[model samples]
Target: MNYKQIVQYGVLIFGAIILIGLVLKGNISHEKFDSEKWKNWTETESELSLRWDMMNSLRNNHELIGKTRTEIIELLGKPDSETKMDFRYYLGMSKHGINTGSLTIKFNENRIVTDFSVWQG
Candidate 1:
Protein backbone atom coordinates (compact mmCIF):
# COMPACT_ATOMS: atom_id res chain seq x y z
CA MET A 1 0.00 0.00 0.00
CA ASN A 2 1.09 3.62 -0.47
CA TYR A 3 2.43 5.61 2.56
CA LYS A 4 -0.53 8.01 2.25
CA GLN A 5 -3.04 5.11 2.36
CA ILE A 6 -1.27 3.57 5.40
CA VAL A 7 -1.38 6.95 7.28
CA GLN A 8 -5.04 7.38 6.43
CA TYR A 9 -5.85 3.88 7.76
CA GLY A 10 -3.81 4.59 10.96
CA VAL A 11 -5.73 7.81 11.59
CA LEU A 12 -9.10 6.02 11.09
CA ILE A 13 -8.11 3.20 13.52
CA PHE A 14 -6.91 5.77 16.12
CA GLY A 15 -10.17 7.68 15.86
CA ALA A 16 -12.20 4.46 16.30
CA ILE A 17 -10.15 3.48 19.39
CA ILE A 18 -10.69 6.89 20.99
CA LEU A 19 -14.43 6.72 20.35
CA ILE A 20 -14.66 3.20 21.82
CA GLY A 21 -12.63 4.27 24.91
CA LEU A 22 -14.99 7.17 25.58
CA VAL A 23 -18.05 4.96 25.13
CA LEU A 24 -16.65 2.29 27.52
CA LYS A 25 -15.58 4.89 30.11
CA GLY A 26 -19.10 6.25 30.36
CA ASN A 27 -22.09 4.06 29.41
CA ILE A 28 -24.53 6.84 28.57
CA SER A 29 -28.16 5.73 28.78
CA HIS A 30 -31.48 7.56 28.72
CA GLU A 31 -33.09 8.22 32.14
CA LYS A 32 -36.75 9.19 32.54
CA PHE A 33 -37.66 11.66 35.29
CA ASP A 34 -41.33 12.40 35.82
CA SER A 35 -41.99 16.09 36.54
CA GLU A 36 -45.13 15.26 38.55
CA LYS A 37 -43.21 12.94 40.88
CA TRP A 38 -40.54 15.61 41.42
CA LYS A 39 -43.22 18.16 42.24
CA ASN A 40 -44.79 15.79 44.82
CA TRP A 41 -41.94 16.50 47.27
CA THR A 42 -43.14 20.12 47.59
CA GLU A 43 -46.13 18.83 49.59
CA THR A 44 -43.77 17.79 52.37
CA GLU A 45 -42.85 21.46 52.89
CA SER A 46 -46.50 22.29 53.49
CA GLU A 47 -46.88 19.36 55.86
CA LEU A 48 -43.86 20.49 57.88
CA SER A 49 -45.23 24.04 58.02
CA LEU A 50 -48.54 22.73 59.36
CA ARG A 51 -46.76 20.72 62.03
CA TRP A 52 -44.75 23.78 63.07
CA ASP A 53 -47.91 25.89 63.34
CA MET A 54 -49.62 23.25 65.49
CA MET A 55 -46.57 22.99 67.74
CA ASN A 56 -46.54 26.78 68.23
CA SER A 57 -50.24 26.79 69.12
CA LEU A 58 -49.79 23.95 71.59
CA ARG A 59 -46.78 25.65 73.17
CA ASN A 60 -48.73 28.87 73.64
CA ASN A 61 -51.63 27.00 75.24
CA HIS A 62 -50.70 23.95 77.28
CA GLU A 63 -54.20 22.64 77.66
CA LEU A 64 -54.45 18.99 76.56
CA ILE A 65 -58.01 17.94 77.31
CA GLY A 66 -60.83 18.14 74.74
CA LYS A 67 -58.20 17.53 72.07
CA THR A 68 -58.26 14.09 70.49
CA ARG A 69 -55.33 11.66 70.51
CA THR A 70 -54.70 12.37 66.82
CA GLU A 71 -54.39 16.09 67.53
CA ILE A 72 -51.97 15.36 70.39
CA ILE A 73 -49.76 13.31 68.11
CA GLU A 74 -49.86 16.04 65.49
CA LEU A 75 -48.83 18.74 67.99
CA LEU A 76 -46.33 16.79 70.09
CA GLY A 77 -44.78 14.70 67.29
CA LYS A 78 -44.18 11.56 69.36
CA PRO A 79 -44.06 10.62 73.02
CA ASP A 80 -40.71 10.14 74.77
CA SER A 81 -41.98 7.23 76.80
CA GLU A 82 -45.11 5.14 77.21
CA THR A 83 -46.04 3.08 80.26
CA LYS A 84 -49.14 1.14 81.19
CA MET A 85 -50.26 1.45 84.77
CA ASP A 86 -52.93 -0.94 86.15
CA PHE A 87 -55.95 1.05 84.95
CA ARG A 88 -54.67 3.78 82.60
CA TYR A 89 -51.97 4.11 79.96
CA TYR A 90 -49.48 6.92 80.38
CA LEU A 91 -47.72 8.68 77.53
CA GLY A 92 -44.99 11.10 78.56
CA MET A 93 -43.01 13.88 76.92
CA SER A 94 -39.67 14.83 78.43
CA LYS A 95 -38.86 18.27 79.78
CA HIS A 96 -36.70 20.35 77.48
CA GLY A 97 -35.62 23.76 78.87
CA ILE A 98 -36.94 26.25 81.42
CA ASN A 99 -39.62 27.52 79.06
CA THR A 100 -40.81 24.07 77.98
CA GLY A 101 -42.99 21.70 80.02
CA SER A 102 -43.54 17.92 79.93
CA LEU A 103 -46.75 16.46 78.56
CA THR A 104 -48.62 13.41 79.87
CA ILE A 105 -51.55 11.71 78.22
CA LYS A 106 -53.82 8.97 79.51
CA PHE A 107 -55.79 6.45 77.48
CA ASN A 108 -58.84 4.44 78.45
CA GLU A 109 -59.64 0.71 78.04
CA ASN A 110 -60.38 0.91 74.32
CA ARG A 111 -57.19 2.84 73.61
CA ILE A 112 -59.21 6.02 73.45
CA VAL A 113 -57.88 9.17 75.08
CA THR A 114 -59.63 9.86 78.40
CA ASP A 115 -57.42 12.55 79.88
CA PHE A 116 -54.23 14.53 79.22
CA SER A 117 -52.27 17.22 81.03
CA VAL A 118 -49.01 19.16 80.91
CA TRP A 119 -46.74 19.75 83.91
CA GLN A 120 -43.92 22.22 84.59
CA GLY A 121 -40.49 20.82 85.23
Candidate 2:
Protein backbone atom coordinates (compact mmCIF):
# COMPACT_ATOMS: atom_id res chain seq x y z
CA MET A 1 0.00 0.00 0.00
CA ASN A 2 1.00 3.61 -0.62
CA TYR A 3 2.09 5.89 2.30
CA LYS A 4 -1.21 7.80 2.15
CA GLN A 5 -3.25 4.59 2.36
CA ILE A 6 -1.20 3.38 5.33
CA VAL A 7 -1.74 6.67 7.19
CA GLN A 8 -5.48 6.57 6.49
CA TYR A 9 -5.75 3.05 7.88
CA GLY A 10 -3.79 4.10 10.97
CA VAL A 11 -6.14 6.97 11.64
CA LEU A 12 -9.18 4.74 11.21
CA ILE A 13 -7.77 2.22 13.66
CA PHE A 14 -7.05 4.93 16.20
CA GLY A 15 -10.58 6.28 15.89
CA ALA A 16 -12.05 2.84 16.44
CA ILE A 17 -9.95 2.33 19.56
CA ILE A 18 -11.12 5.63 21.00
CA LEU A 19 -14.75 4.85 20.29
CA ILE A 20 -14.51 1.49 22.01
CA GLY A 21 -12.82 3.01 25.02
CA LEU A 22 -15.55 5.61 25.37
CA VAL A 23 -18.26 2.99 25.18
CA LEU A 24 -16.65 0.89 27.90
CA LYS A 25 -15.90 3.84 30.12
CA GLY A 26 -19.51 5.00 29.95
CA ASN A 27 -20.73 1.89 31.88
CA ILE A 28 -23.54 1.11 29.49
CA SER A 29 -25.17 -1.42 31.80
CA HIS A 30 -28.90 -0.78 32.27
CA GLU A 31 -29.59 -2.87 35.36
CA LYS A 32 -33.01 -2.61 36.86
CA PHE A 33 -33.40 -1.12 40.33
CA ASP A 34 -32.96 -3.75 43.01
CA SER A 35 -33.56 -2.40 46.47
CA GLU A 36 -32.09 -5.47 48.12
CA LYS A 37 -28.83 -5.20 46.25
CA TRP A 38 -28.68 -1.47 46.69
CA LYS A 39 -29.15 -1.53 50.43
CA ASN A 40 -26.80 -4.46 50.82
CA TRP A 41 -23.84 -2.79 49.15
CA THR A 42 -21.11 -1.95 51.65
CA GLU A 43 -18.34 0.59 51.39
CA THR A 44 -15.75 -1.94 50.33
CA GLU A 45 -17.96 -3.42 47.61
CA SER A 46 -19.01 0.09 46.62
CA GLU A 47 -15.56 0.90 45.31
CA LEU A 48 -15.50 -2.11 43.01
CA SER A 49 -19.13 -2.26 41.93
CA LEU A 50 -20.53 0.99 40.67
CA ARG A 51 -24.27 1.57 40.85
CA TRP A 52 -24.83 3.93 37.92
CA ASP A 53 -26.74 1.22 36.08
CA MET A 54 -29.37 0.84 38.76
CA MET A 55 -29.36 4.57 39.41
CA ASN A 56 -30.38 5.14 35.82
CA SER A 57 -33.35 2.87 36.23
CA LEU A 58 -34.28 4.36 39.58
CA ARG A 59 -34.32 7.86 38.14
CA ASN A 60 -36.24 6.86 35.05
CA ASN A 61 -38.73 4.41 36.51
CA HIS A 62 -39.54 6.16 39.77
CA GLU A 63 -41.45 9.40 39.90
CA LEU A 64 -39.47 10.91 42.76
CA ILE A 65 -39.70 14.55 41.78
CA GLY A 66 -42.80 15.15 43.84
CA LYS A 67 -42.51 12.40 46.42
CA THR A 68 -42.24 13.26 50.08
CA ARG A 69 -39.00 12.74 51.97
CA THR A 70 -40.56 9.92 53.92
CA GLU A 71 -41.74 8.26 50.74
CA ILE A 72 -38.29 8.47 49.22
CA ILE A 73 -36.74 6.90 52.25
CA GLU A 74 -39.29 4.11 52.07
CA LEU A 75 -38.25 3.43 48.52
CA LEU A 76 -34.50 4.01 48.73
CA GLY A 77 -33.77 3.36 52.39
CA LYS A 78 -31.87 5.76 54.66
CA PRO A 79 -29.49 8.36 53.29
CA ASP A 80 -25.79 8.29 53.94
CA SER A 81 -26.03 11.94 54.85
CA GLU A 82 -28.82 14.42 55.27
CA THR A 83 -29.70 17.99 56.07
CA LYS A 84 -32.91 19.80 56.78
CA MET A 85 -33.70 20.09 53.08
CA ASP A 86 -31.84 17.30 51.40
CA PHE A 87 -30.79 13.64 51.55
CA ARG A 88 -27.69 12.23 49.95
CA TYR A 89 -27.35 8.53 49.20
CA TYR A 90 -23.90 7.15 48.57
CA LEU A 91 -24.00 5.48 45.16
CA GLY A 92 -20.51 4.11 45.19
CA MET A 93 -17.63 4.80 42.82
CA SER A 94 -18.04 6.13 39.33
CA LYS A 95 -17.36 3.93 36.34
CA HIS A 96 -14.43 6.15 35.44
CA GLY A 97 -12.79 4.82 38.62
CA ILE A 98 -11.58 8.24 39.79
CA ASN A 99 -14.52 9.61 41.74
CA THR A 100 -17.12 8.44 44.22
CA GLY A 101 -20.75 9.00 43.30
CA SER A 102 -23.89 9.93 45.21
CA LEU A 103 -27.47 10.80 44.60
CA THR A 104 -28.63 14.02 46.21
CA ILE A 105 -32.31 14.72 46.64
CA LYS A 106 -33.35 18.24 47.49
CA PHE A 107 -36.57 19.00 49.30
CA ASN A 108 -38.68 22.08 49.82
CA GLU A 109 -40.23 23.57 52.91
CA ASN A 110 -43.05 21.05 52.89
CA ARG A 111 -40.52 18.21 53.01
CA ILE A 112 -41.27 17.18 49.47
CA VAL A 113 -38.72 16.33 46.91
CA THR A 114 -38.14 19.24 44.58
CA ASP A 115 -35.16 18.08 42.59
CA PHE A 116 -32.58 15.36 42.54
CA SER A 117 -29.16 14.93 40.99
CA VAL A 118 -26.36 12.41 40.62
CA TRP A 119 -22.95 13.76 41.41
CA GLN A 120 -19.35 12.51 41.49
CA GLY A 121 -16.33 13.61 43.44
Q: lDDT by residue for model 1 over 62-92, one digit each (tens)?
A: 5555555555555444455665511221212
Off by over 4 Å in 2: 1-26, 45-47
Clashing residue pairs for model 2: none
User: Candidate 2 has what TM-score?
Assistant: 0.74
Best by lDDT: 2
Q: Candidate 1: RMSD over Cα atoms?
A: 22.2
Looking at candidate 1, the ten consecutive residues that score lowest on lDDT are 85-94
Candidate 1, position 10, lDDT: 100
